[model samples]
Target: MDHPLLLAFGLLLVVEGLFPLLAPQAWKDTFSRLIGLRDGQLRTIGLIGVALGVALLVSFS
Candidate 1:
């Protein structure tokens, strides 16, 4: 795409889809475990993901 935002979003989709595409069972298993996690734990995981994503975007761009 002509826009950097579109390019980044497309890359994000590709990366997000790869794991489930390659290992559907494993992907399901991961979410099954995630379901057992407490809300706080899930929040922490999500926060970390966001932080790292921001860090990577800053460093790369």
Candidate 2:
């Protein structure tokens, strides 16, 4: 339902904002390090994230 979807998005925003809100310097440092990663490395990380998300959705559904 729309309610559940909205709650999911809200929770996602909260979780995504935690690092920057609680440890801004650390978050910036992480971004700086990420900037040095190769495109292939970034792609691999993204693929893993997508795969994990899909696996979680499948298990939950």
Candidate 3:
């Protein structure tokens, strides 16, 4: 796998995961629901995010 996208996704996961950790009660319930999603759902969402990011980069190029 080309690593830049994977690195970006890893960074995204850390930042996204931090939101709930930092805010605690405010975002806890919302994140908890997302945490329960089936594996496929999460993967789809992650792929969408990566695709969108790539689209943005390509557009600028």
Best by lDDT: 1
Candidate 2 pairs with clashing backbones: none
Task: State which candidate, 1 or 3, has the greater lDDT.
Answer: 1
Candidate 2: list runs displaced more than 4 Å.
none
Sort by TM-score, best first: what order?
A: 1, 2, 3
Clashing pairs in 3: none
lDDT of 2 by residue, 13-40 (tens): 9999999999999999999999999999
Stretches > 4 Å off in candidate 1: none
- RMSD for each model, in Å, please? 0.9, 1.4, 5.3
lDDT digits (tens) for residues 1-61 of candidate 1: 5799988889889999999999999999999999999999999999999999999989998
- For residues 1-61, what per-residue lDDT tens digits would candidate 3 score against the true structure? 6798798789889998897779878797877899899999999999999999889989987
**Alpha-carbon RMSD, candidate 3:** 5.3
Q: Count clashing residue pairs per candidate.
A: 0, 0, 0
| Alpha carbon lDDT of each predicted model | 0.96, 0.95, 0.88
Tell me, by TM-score, which candidate is best.
1
In model 1, pairs of residues that clash are none
TM-score list, all predictions: 0.91, 0.89, 0.55
